[model samples]
Target: MTKVIAIVNQKGGVAKTTTAINVGAGLAKHNKRVLLIDLDGQGNLSRGLGCKTKARNQFTIRDALLNIQKGILTNPTKGILTARYEKISVMPANKQLDAFEHSLKGDLDAPFYLRRYVNTLRQYFDVILIDCSPSLGLMTLNALVAADSVMIPVDPEFFGVEGVEQIVAAMTDVQRKMNPSLSLEGIVIVRRNDISIAKRTNAKNLRLRYGSKVFQTELPTSVKASEASARGMSLLEYMSWNHLARAYASLVEEVLANGRN
Candidate 1:
Protein backbone atom coordinates (compact mmCIF):
# COMPACT_ATOMS: atom_id res chain seq x y z
CA MET A 1 0.00 0.00 0.00
CA THR A 2 1.08 3.56 -0.66
CA LYS A 3 1.60 5.91 2.26
CA VAL A 4 1.36 9.66 1.95
CA ILE A 5 3.42 11.86 4.28
CA ALA A 6 3.16 15.63 4.25
CA ILE A 7 6.21 17.48 5.46
CA VAL A 8 4.85 20.78 6.71
CA ASN A 9 5.62 23.86 8.78
CA GLN A 10 3.93 27.21 8.47
CA LYS A 11 7.24 28.94 9.09
CA GLY A 12 9.66 29.21 6.19
CA GLY A 13 13.33 28.14 6.43
CA VAL A 14 12.35 25.22 8.65
CA ALA A 15 13.62 22.56 6.26
CA LYS A 16 10.19 21.28 5.23
CA THR A 17 11.38 21.03 1.67
CA THR A 18 14.76 19.81 2.79
CA THR A 19 13.14 17.00 4.77
CA ALA A 20 10.88 16.13 1.85
CA ILE A 21 13.76 15.99 -0.62
CA ASN A 22 16.18 14.04 1.48
CA VAL A 23 13.61 11.69 2.99
CA GLY A 24 12.28 10.92 -0.46
CA ALA A 25 15.84 10.35 -1.61
CA GLY A 26 16.53 8.19 1.39
CA LEU A 27 13.47 6.07 0.68
CA ALA A 28 14.43 5.81 -2.96
CA LYS A 29 17.95 4.79 -2.00
CA HIS A 30 16.32 1.86 -0.23
CA ASN A 31 14.59 0.93 -3.52
CA LYS A 32 11.23 2.29 -2.54
CA ARG A 33 9.32 3.79 -5.45
CA VAL A 34 8.64 7.35 -4.33
CA LEU A 35 6.56 10.12 -5.80
CA LEU A 36 7.17 13.63 -4.52
CA ILE A 37 4.44 16.20 -4.93
CA ASP A 38 5.43 19.86 -4.73
CA LEU A 39 2.43 21.87 -3.61
CA ASP A 40 4.42 25.06 -2.94
CA GLY A 41 3.97 27.82 -5.47
CA GLN A 42 7.64 28.75 -5.12
CA GLY A 43 8.42 25.38 -6.73
CA ASN A 44 11.48 25.13 -4.54
CA LEU A 45 10.84 21.45 -3.90
CA SER A 46 10.46 20.88 -7.60
CA ARG A 47 13.65 22.77 -8.36
CA GLY A 48 15.55 21.17 -5.51
CA LEU A 49 14.71 17.81 -7.08
CA GLY A 50 16.36 19.12 -10.29
CA CYS A 51 13.33 20.30 -12.22
CA LYS A 52 13.90 23.54 -14.12
CA THR A 53 10.29 24.63 -13.96
CA LYS A 54 9.50 27.82 -15.85
CA ALA A 55 6.82 30.48 -15.40
CA ARG A 56 4.52 29.11 -18.09
CA ASN A 57 4.83 25.54 -16.96
CA GLN A 58 1.22 24.43 -17.05
CA PHE A 59 1.93 20.82 -16.17
CA THR A 60 1.53 21.06 -12.43
CA ILE A 61 -0.71 20.43 -9.47
CA ARG A 62 -2.96 23.08 -10.98
CA ASP A 63 -3.88 20.84 -13.87
CA ALA A 64 -4.34 17.90 -11.55
CA LEU A 65 -6.68 19.86 -9.30
CA LEU A 66 -8.56 21.10 -12.32
CA ASN A 67 -9.03 17.52 -13.39
CA ILE A 68 -10.35 16.63 -9.96
CA GLN A 69 -12.69 19.59 -10.19
CA LYS A 70 -13.92 18.17 -13.49
CA GLY A 71 -14.73 14.88 -11.72
CA ILE A 72 -11.85 12.96 -13.24
CA LEU A 73 -8.56 11.58 -12.04
CA THR A 74 -5.60 13.00 -13.91
CA ASN A 75 -2.71 10.90 -15.08
CA PRO A 76 -0.18 13.18 -13.45
CA THR A 77 2.69 10.85 -14.19
CA LYS A 78 2.81 12.33 -17.68
CA GLY A 79 4.51 15.36 -16.16
CA ILE A 80 6.33 13.72 -13.24
CA LEU A 81 10.09 14.32 -13.45
CA THR A 82 12.35 11.35 -12.79
CA ALA A 83 15.24 11.71 -10.38
CA ARG A 84 17.86 9.62 -8.53
CA TYR A 85 18.01 7.12 -11.37
CA GLU A 86 14.21 6.78 -11.58
CA LYS A 87 13.70 5.62 -8.02
CA ILE A 88 11.87 8.89 -7.39
CA SER A 89 9.34 10.83 -9.44
CA VAL A 90 8.04 14.32 -8.76
CA MET A 91 4.99 16.28 -9.75
CA PRO A 92 6.47 19.73 -10.17
CA ALA A 93 4.69 22.94 -9.23
CA ASN A 94 4.95 26.55 -10.36
CA LYS A 95 3.57 30.00 -9.57
CA GLN A 96 0.39 28.79 -11.18
CA LEU A 97 -0.53 27.23 -7.84
CA ASP A 98 -1.07 30.72 -6.46
CA ALA A 99 -3.73 31.33 -9.05
CA PHE A 100 -5.08 27.83 -8.51
CA GLU A 101 -5.67 28.61 -4.84
CA HIS A 102 -7.18 31.94 -5.76
CA SER A 103 -9.55 30.11 -8.03
CA LEU A 104 -10.48 27.79 -5.17
CA LYS A 105 -11.66 30.56 -2.91
CA GLY A 106 -15.14 29.73 -1.58
CA ASP A 107 -15.01 26.28 -3.16
CA LEU A 108 -16.35 24.00 -0.47
CA ASP A 109 -14.18 21.09 -1.56
CA ALA A 110 -10.89 22.88 -2.07
CA PRO A 111 -9.19 20.67 0.46
CA PHE A 112 -10.75 17.55 -0.96
CA TYR A 113 -9.44 18.05 -4.46
CA LEU A 114 -5.92 16.98 -3.63
CA ARG A 115 -7.27 13.98 -1.80
CA ARG A 116 -9.28 13.03 -4.84
CA TYR A 117 -6.25 13.54 -7.07
CA VAL A 118 -3.96 11.48 -4.90
CA ASN A 119 -6.48 8.69 -4.58
CA THR A 120 -5.67 7.77 -8.16
CA LEU A 121 -1.93 7.55 -7.55
CA ARG A 122 -1.70 5.04 -4.73
CA GLN A 123 -1.04 2.05 -6.91
CA TYR A 124 1.98 3.41 -8.74
CA PHE A 125 4.35 4.08 -5.87
CA ASP A 126 5.12 2.71 -2.46
CA VAL A 127 5.20 6.20 -1.02
CA ILE A 128 3.85 9.62 -1.94
CA LEU A 129 5.23 12.59 -0.02
CA ILE A 130 3.68 16.01 -0.36
CA ASP A 131 5.98 18.96 0.25
CA CYS A 132 3.46 21.50 1.51
CA SER A 133 3.92 25.22 1.10
CA PRO A 134 4.85 26.94 4.34
CA SER A 135 1.29 27.65 5.37
CA LEU A 136 -1.89 26.02 6.62
CA GLY A 137 -3.98 26.98 3.66
CA LEU A 138 -6.22 25.03 1.34
CA MET A 139 -3.25 23.25 -0.20
CA THR A 140 -1.89 22.10 3.13
CA LEU A 141 -5.40 21.14 4.19
CA ASN A 142 -5.70 19.10 1.08
CA ALA A 143 -2.36 17.49 1.80
CA LEU A 144 -3.42 16.61 5.32
CA VAL A 145 -6.69 15.22 4.10
CA ALA A 146 -4.89 13.11 1.55
CA ALA A 147 -2.06 11.91 3.71
CA ASP A 148 -1.92 9.04 6.16
CA SER A 149 0.36 11.09 8.39
CA VAL A 150 2.37 14.31 8.66
CA MET A 151 6.02 15.00 9.43
CA ILE A 152 6.88 18.44 10.71
CA PRO A 153 10.42 19.79 10.38
CA VAL A 154 11.11 22.16 13.23
CA ASP A 155 14.16 24.37 13.13
CA PRO A 156 16.12 24.61 16.36
CA GLU A 157 14.89 28.07 17.21
CA PHE A 158 12.38 29.80 19.46
CA PHE A 159 9.61 30.30 16.93
CA GLY A 160 9.97 26.72 15.81
CA VAL A 161 8.18 25.48 18.89
CA GLU A 162 5.40 28.03 18.42
CA GLY A 163 5.00 27.06 14.78
CA VAL A 164 4.70 23.38 15.71
CA GLU A 165 1.89 24.26 18.08
CA GLN A 166 0.09 26.12 15.32
CA ILE A 167 0.48 23.26 12.85
CA VAL A 168 -0.55 20.68 15.45
CA ALA A 169 -3.70 22.63 16.24
CA ALA A 170 -4.42 22.94 12.57
CA MET A 171 -3.88 19.24 12.04
CA THR A 172 -6.21 18.46 14.90
CA ASP A 173 -8.82 20.65 13.28
CA VAL A 174 -8.28 18.93 9.96
CA GLN A 175 -8.60 15.55 11.60
CA ARG A 176 -11.84 16.52 13.29
CA LYS A 177 -13.39 18.16 10.27
CA MET A 178 -11.66 16.91 7.13
CA ASN A 179 -9.45 13.85 7.59
CA PRO A 180 -9.88 11.76 10.67
CA SER A 181 -7.13 9.49 9.39
CA LEU A 182 -4.50 12.19 9.48
CA SER A 183 -2.16 11.68 12.39
CA LEU A 184 1.11 13.48 13.02
CA GLU A 185 3.74 10.81 12.40
CA GLY A 186 6.66 12.62 14.04
CA ILE A 187 8.59 15.87 14.28
CA VAL A 188 12.18 16.21 13.11
CA ILE A 189 14.54 18.91 14.34
CA VAL A 190 16.51 20.51 11.52
CA ARG A 191 19.50 22.82 11.25
CA ARG A 192 20.34 21.71 14.75
CA ASN A 193 24.00 21.96 15.57
CA ASP A 194 23.01 21.91 19.26
CA ILE A 195 26.17 23.87 19.96
CA SER A 196 24.45 26.28 22.34
CA ILE A 197 22.41 26.01 25.48
CA ALA A 198 19.50 27.69 23.72
CA LYS A 199 19.46 25.13 20.92
CA ARG A 200 19.71 22.29 23.38
CA THR A 201 16.94 23.81 25.46
CA ASN A 202 14.72 24.14 22.42
CA ALA A 203 15.30 20.51 21.49
CA LYS A 204 14.51 19.38 25.01
CA ASN A 205 11.35 21.46 25.08
CA LEU A 206 10.18 20.03 21.76
CA ARG A 207 10.78 16.43 22.79
CA LEU A 208 9.12 17.10 26.13
CA ARG A 209 6.16 18.63 24.38
CA TYR A 210 5.79 15.98 21.68
CA GLY A 211 7.41 13.09 23.52
CA SER A 212 8.07 10.05 21.34
CA LYS A 213 6.22 11.82 18.57
CA VAL A 214 9.45 13.72 17.99
CA PHE A 215 11.77 11.82 15.69
CA GLN A 216 15.05 10.67 17.22
CA THR A 217 16.98 11.79 14.13
CA GLU A 218 18.04 15.44 13.93
CA LEU A 219 19.87 17.13 11.06
CA PRO A 220 22.67 19.43 12.15
CA THR A 221 23.49 22.69 10.41
CA SER A 222 25.51 21.69 7.37
CA VAL A 223 26.80 23.65 4.41
CA LYS A 224 26.53 20.54 2.30
CA ALA A 225 22.72 20.73 2.41
CA SER A 226 22.84 24.19 0.86
CA GLU A 227 25.32 23.02 -1.72
CA ALA A 228 23.12 20.06 -2.58
CA SER A 229 20.15 22.37 -3.11
CA ALA A 230 22.29 24.64 -5.23
CA ARG A 231 23.15 21.67 -7.40
CA GLY A 232 19.49 20.54 -7.51
CA MET A 233 20.35 17.19 -5.99
CA SER A 234 19.61 15.16 -2.89
CA LEU A 235 22.34 15.08 -0.25
CA LEU A 236 22.71 11.33 -0.69
CA GLU A 237 23.28 11.80 -4.39
CA TYR A 238 25.49 14.83 -3.94
CA MET A 239 27.67 13.33 -1.22
CA SER A 240 26.67 9.88 -0.07
CA TRP A 241 29.24 10.01 2.73
CA ASN A 242 27.86 13.28 4.13
CA HIS A 243 26.51 13.08 7.66
CA LEU A 244 23.26 14.69 6.44
CA ALA A 245 22.69 11.67 4.24
CA ARG A 246 23.24 9.36 7.19
CA ALA A 247 20.80 11.44 9.25
CA TYR A 248 18.09 11.29 6.60
CA ALA A 249 18.66 7.59 6.13
CA SER A 250 18.07 7.07 9.82
CA LEU A 251 14.94 9.18 9.54
CA VAL A 252 13.65 6.95 6.78
CA GLU A 253 14.10 3.95 9.00
CA GLU A 254 12.15 5.63 11.77
CA VAL A 255 9.37 6.44 9.30
CA LEU A 256 9.21 2.89 8.06
CA ALA A 257 9.28 1.65 11.62
CA ASN A 258 6.28 3.81 12.29
CA GLY A 259 4.76 1.96 9.31
CA ARG A 260 1.28 3.42 8.98
CA ASN A 261 0.71 3.46 12.70
Candidate 2:
Protein backbone atom coordinates (compact mmCIF):
# COMPACT_ATOMS: atom_id res chain seq x y z
CA MET A 1 0.00 0.00 0.00
CA THR A 2 1.28 3.45 -0.89
CA LYS A 3 0.82 6.48 1.37
CA VAL A 4 -0.29 9.31 -0.89
CA ILE A 5 0.76 12.64 0.66
CA ALA A 6 0.14 15.96 -1.00
CA ILE A 7 2.72 18.69 -0.29
CA VAL A 8 0.42 21.67 -0.40
CA ASN A 9 0.25 25.39 0.46
CA GLN A 10 -2.21 27.94 -0.91
CA LYS A 11 0.55 30.54 -1.03
CA GLY A 12 3.47 30.53 -3.43
CA GLY A 13 7.17 30.70 -2.38
CA VAL A 14 6.54 28.45 0.59
CA ALA A 15 8.82 25.72 -0.73
CA LYS A 16 5.98 23.28 -1.48
CA THR A 17 7.76 21.85 -4.52
CA THR A 18 11.10 21.83 -2.69
CA THR A 19 9.61 19.85 0.18
CA ALA A 20 7.95 17.40 -2.24
CA ILE A 21 11.11 16.80 -4.24
CA ASN A 22 13.49 16.44 -1.29
CA VAL A 23 11.11 14.34 0.80
CA GLY A 24 10.41 12.01 -2.14
CA ALA A 25 14.10 11.82 -2.99
CA GLY A 26 15.04 11.28 0.63
CA LEU A 27 12.55 8.44 0.95
CA ALA A 28 13.98 6.88 -2.18
CA LYS A 29 17.43 7.05 -0.60
CA HIS A 30 15.95 5.13 2.35
CA ASN A 31 15.34 2.21 -0.02
CA LYS A 32 11.64 3.00 -0.20
CA ARG A 33 10.24 3.20 -3.72
CA VAL A 34 8.65 6.62 -4.18
CA LEU A 35 6.73 8.31 -6.96
CA LEU A 36 6.37 12.09 -7.37
CA ILE A 37 3.30 13.49 -9.10
CA ASP A 38 3.50 17.04 -10.39
CA LEU A 39 -0.07 18.28 -9.99
CA ASP A 40 0.75 21.92 -10.68
CA GLY A 41 0.47 22.79 -14.35
CA GLN A 42 3.58 24.99 -13.99
CA GLY A 43 5.77 21.84 -14.10
CA ASN A 44 8.22 23.14 -11.50
CA LEU A 45 8.50 19.78 -9.79
CA SER A 46 8.90 18.13 -13.18
CA ARG A 47 11.83 20.40 -14.07
CA GLY A 48 13.27 20.15 -10.55
CA LEU A 49 13.52 16.40 -10.96
CA GLY A 50 15.28 16.70 -14.30
CA CYS A 51 12.19 16.15 -16.42
CA LYS A 52 11.61 18.47 -19.35
CA THR A 53 7.89 18.53 -20.12
CA LYS A 54 7.77 19.28 -23.81
CA ALA A 55 5.85 16.87 -26.04
CA ARG A 56 2.38 15.51 -25.37
CA ASN A 57 3.36 11.94 -26.27
CA GLN A 58 5.75 12.07 -23.30
CA PHE A 59 2.73 11.37 -21.09
CA THR A 60 2.21 13.74 -18.16
CA ILE A 61 -0.27 13.48 -15.27
CA ARG A 62 -2.51 15.77 -17.29
CA ASP A 63 -2.27 13.44 -20.28
CA ALA A 64 -3.06 10.46 -18.07
CA LEU A 65 -6.17 12.07 -16.62
CA LEU A 66 -7.37 13.34 -19.96
CA ASN A 67 -6.61 10.04 -21.67
CA ILE A 68 -8.44 8.12 -18.97
CA GLN A 69 -11.37 10.53 -19.21
CA LYS A 70 -11.47 10.20 -23.00
CA GLY A 71 -11.05 6.38 -23.01
CA ILE A 72 -7.69 6.66 -24.77
CA LEU A 73 -5.58 5.22 -21.94
CA THR A 74 -7.00 2.19 -20.19
CA ASN A 75 -4.27 1.78 -17.59
CA PRO A 76 -3.60 4.85 -15.45
CA THR A 77 -0.31 3.47 -14.09
CA LYS A 78 1.08 3.55 -17.62
CA GLY A 79 1.39 7.32 -17.26
CA ILE A 80 4.10 7.15 -14.59
CA LEU A 81 7.37 8.42 -16.08
CA THR A 82 10.86 7.65 -14.86
CA ALA A 83 12.81 10.56 -13.44
CA ARG A 84 16.61 11.03 -13.21
CA TYR A 85 16.58 10.07 -9.56
CA GLU A 86 16.83 6.40 -8.72
CA LYS A 87 14.04 4.58 -6.87
CA ILE A 88 11.53 7.28 -7.80
CA SER A 89 9.03 7.85 -10.61
CA VAL A 90 7.18 10.98 -11.75
CA MET A 91 3.96 12.01 -13.47
CA PRO A 92 5.12 15.28 -14.96
CA ALA A 93 2.84 18.19 -15.89
CA ASN A 94 3.21 21.31 -17.98
CA LYS A 95 1.35 24.49 -18.93
CA GLN A 96 -1.01 22.43 -21.09
CA LEU A 97 -2.59 21.08 -17.90
CA ASP A 98 -4.63 24.28 -17.53
CA ALA A 99 -6.65 23.30 -20.60
CA PHE A 100 -7.27 19.85 -19.18
CA GLU A 101 -8.62 21.35 -15.94
CA HIS A 102 -10.91 23.56 -17.98
CA SER A 103 -12.13 20.55 -19.90
CA LEU A 104 -13.37 19.05 -16.63
CA LYS A 105 -14.63 22.29 -15.05
CA GLY A 106 -18.15 21.32 -14.00
CA ASP A 107 -17.79 17.55 -14.25
CA LEU A 108 -19.14 16.09 -11.01
CA ASP A 109 -16.32 13.57 -10.69
CA ALA A 110 -13.44 15.90 -11.46
CA PRO A 111 -12.22 15.94 -7.90
CA PHE A 112 -11.80 12.15 -7.90
CA TYR A 113 -9.67 11.81 -11.02
CA LEU A 114 -6.37 11.81 -9.14
CA ARG A 115 -7.68 9.27 -6.65
CA ARG A 116 -8.65 6.96 -9.49
CA TYR A 117 -5.30 7.46 -11.18
CA VAL A 118 -3.35 6.79 -7.97
CA ASN A 119 -5.33 3.62 -7.29
CA THR A 120 -3.58 1.84 -10.15
CA LEU A 121 -0.07 2.60 -8.83
CA ARG A 122 -0.57 1.87 -5.13
CA GLN A 123 1.09 -1.53 -5.07
CA TYR A 124 4.19 -0.36 -6.91
CA PHE A 125 5.49 2.30 -4.50
CA ASP A 126 5.91 2.91 -0.80
CA VAL A 127 4.97 6.59 -1.03
CA ILE A 128 3.51 9.02 -3.54
CA LEU A 129 3.98 12.77 -3.10
CA ILE A 130 1.81 15.18 -5.08
CA ASP A 131 3.27 18.67 -5.53
CA CYS A 132 0.30 20.99 -5.89
CA SER A 133 -0.03 24.52 -7.17
CA PRO A 134 -0.14 27.44 -4.73
CA SER A 135 -3.87 27.85 -4.86
CA LEU A 136 -7.13 26.31 -3.61
CA GLY A 137 -8.53 25.64 -7.04
CA LEU A 138 -9.75 22.42 -8.65
CA MET A 139 -6.25 21.03 -9.19
CA THR A 140 -5.35 21.38 -5.53
CA LEU A 141 -8.76 20.03 -4.58
CA ASN A 142 -8.11 16.92 -6.66
CA ALA A 143 -4.80 16.32 -4.92
CA LEU A 144 -6.35 16.81 -1.48
CA VAL A 145 -9.21 14.45 -2.27
CA ALA A 146 -6.83 11.79 -3.56
CA ALA A 147 -4.26 12.02 -0.78
CA ASP A 148 -4.34 10.13 2.50
CA SER A 149 -2.57 13.05 4.16
CA VAL A 150 -1.31 16.54 3.41
CA MET A 151 1.95 18.24 4.51
CA ILE A 152 2.07 22.01 4.37
CA PRO A 153 5.32 23.95 3.97
CA VAL A 154 4.70 27.29 5.63
CA ASP A 155 7.31 29.89 4.89
CA PRO A 156 8.37 31.83 8.02
CA GLU A 157 7.27 35.11 6.52
CA PHE A 158 4.39 37.33 7.69
CA PHE A 159 1.56 35.94 5.55
CA GLY A 160 2.59 32.39 6.38
CA VAL A 161 0.13 32.42 9.26
CA GLU A 162 -2.72 33.44 6.98
CA GLY A 163 -1.71 30.79 4.46
CA VAL A 164 -1.86 28.14 7.14
CA GLU A 165 -5.33 29.29 8.19
CA GLN A 166 -6.65 29.15 4.64
CA ILE A 167 -5.31 25.65 4.06
CA VAL A 168 -6.67 24.41 7.38
CA ALA A 169 -10.15 25.59 6.44
CA ALA A 170 -9.88 23.95 3.05
CA MET A 171 -8.66 20.70 4.57
CA THR A 172 -11.57 20.69 6.97
CA ASP A 173 -13.94 21.18 4.05
CA VAL A 174 -12.30 18.35 2.13
CA GLN A 175 -12.58 15.96 5.04
CA ARG A 176 -16.23 16.85 5.54
CA LYS A 177 -17.41 16.90 1.92
CA MET A 178 -14.70 15.18 -0.13
CA ASN A 179 -12.29 12.65 1.42
CA PRO A 180 -13.22 11.76 4.94
CA SER A 181 -10.01 9.78 5.43
CA LEU A 182 -7.82 12.81 4.87
CA SER A 183 -5.34 13.59 7.67
CA LEU A 184 -2.75 16.25 8.24
CA GLU A 185 0.76 14.84 7.92
CA GLY A 186 2.62 17.86 9.34
CA ILE A 187 3.36 21.55 8.95
CA VAL A 188 6.99 22.36 8.17
CA ILE A 189 8.29 25.92 8.66
CA VAL A 190 10.55 26.71 5.73
CA ARG A 191 13.19 29.42 5.19
CA ARG A 192 13.41 30.38 8.84
CA ASN A 193 16.00 32.75 10.16
CA ASP A 194 15.98 32.46 13.91
CA ILE A 195 17.79 35.76 14.33
CA SER A 196 15.06 37.75 12.64
CA ILE A 197 12.34 38.86 15.03
CA ALA A 198 9.67 38.89 12.32
CA LYS A 199 10.39 35.33 11.34
CA ARG A 200 10.54 34.24 14.96
CA THR A 201 7.23 35.93 15.78
CA ASN A 202 5.43 34.30 12.85
CA ALA A 203 6.84 30.88 13.62
CA LYS A 204 5.77 31.26 17.23
CA ASN A 205 2.23 32.02 16.08
CA LEU A 206 2.21 28.91 13.92
CA ARG A 207 3.39 26.78 16.82
CA LEU A 208 0.79 28.27 19.12
CA ARG A 209 -1.97 27.39 16.68
CA TYR A 210 -0.94 24.10 15.08
CA GLY A 211 1.07 22.79 18.07
CA SER A 212 2.33 19.22 17.48
CA LYS A 213 1.40 19.30 13.80
CA VAL A 214 4.46 21.45 13.19
CA PHE A 215 7.67 19.57 12.48
CA GLN A 216 10.75 20.36 14.60
CA THR A 217 12.91 20.86 11.56
CA GLU A 218 13.05 24.34 10.03
CA LEU A 219 14.61 24.63 6.57
CA PRO A 220 16.70 27.75 6.16
CA THR A 221 17.08 29.84 3.03
CA SER A 222 19.75 28.37 0.81
CA VAL A 223 21.21 29.37 -2.48
CA LYS A 224 22.09 25.72 -2.93
CA ALA A 225 18.43 24.93 -3.59
CA SER A 226 18.39 27.16 -6.65
CA GLU A 227 21.78 25.83 -7.73
CA ALA A 228 20.51 22.28 -7.42
CA SER A 229 17.42 23.17 -9.44
CA ALA A 230 19.63 24.79 -12.04
CA ARG A 231 21.40 21.45 -12.39
CA GLY A 232 18.05 19.62 -12.18
CA MET A 233 18.80 17.67 -8.99
CA SER A 234 17.51 17.34 -5.44
CA LEU A 235 19.32 18.82 -2.45
CA LEU A 236 20.33 15.33 -1.41
CA GLU A 237 22.16 14.89 -4.70
CA TYR A 238 23.38 18.48 -4.88
CA MET A 239 25.08 18.67 -1.46
CA SER A 240 24.32 15.77 0.83
CA TRP A 241 26.86 16.89 3.43
CA ASN A 242 25.26 20.28 4.05
CA HIS A 243 22.71 21.43 6.64
CA LEU A 244 20.03 21.94 3.97
CA ALA A 245 20.18 18.27 3.10
CA ARG A 246 20.05 17.30 6.76
CA ALA A 247 16.96 19.45 7.34
CA TYR A 248 15.11 17.70 4.54
CA ALA A 249 16.30 14.33 5.76
CA SER A 250 14.88 15.03 9.22
CA LEU A 251 11.59 16.11 7.67
CA VAL A 252 11.48 12.82 5.76
CA GLU A 253 11.79 10.87 9.00
CA GLU A 254 8.81 12.74 10.42
CA VAL A 255 6.89 12.14 7.21
CA LEU A 256 7.54 8.41 7.37
CA ALA A 257 6.57 8.23 11.04
CA ASN A 258 3.37 10.24 10.59
CA GLY A 259 2.05 8.39 7.57
CA ARG A 260 0.52 4.96 8.26
CA ASN A 261 0.39 3.05 5.02
Best by the TM-score measure: 2
lDDT of 1: 0.85
- TM-score for every candidate vs. truth? 0.94, 0.95
Tens-digit per-residue lDDT, 65-92, candidate 1: 8878987744656677786343679998
CA deviation > 4 Å runs, candidate 2:
71-73
- Stretches of candidate 1 exceeding 4 Å from the true structure: 55-57, 84-86
Cα lDDT tens digits for candidate 2, 1-261: 679999888888788998888998899998889999999889998899888798647778887887657657476577677767545798899988988988897799899888888877888888999999988999899999999999998877655578788898999999999899999888999887656787788899999988999998999888898888777789988898778888999988887777643
Output the TM-score of candidate 2: 0.95
Model 1 has a clash total of 0
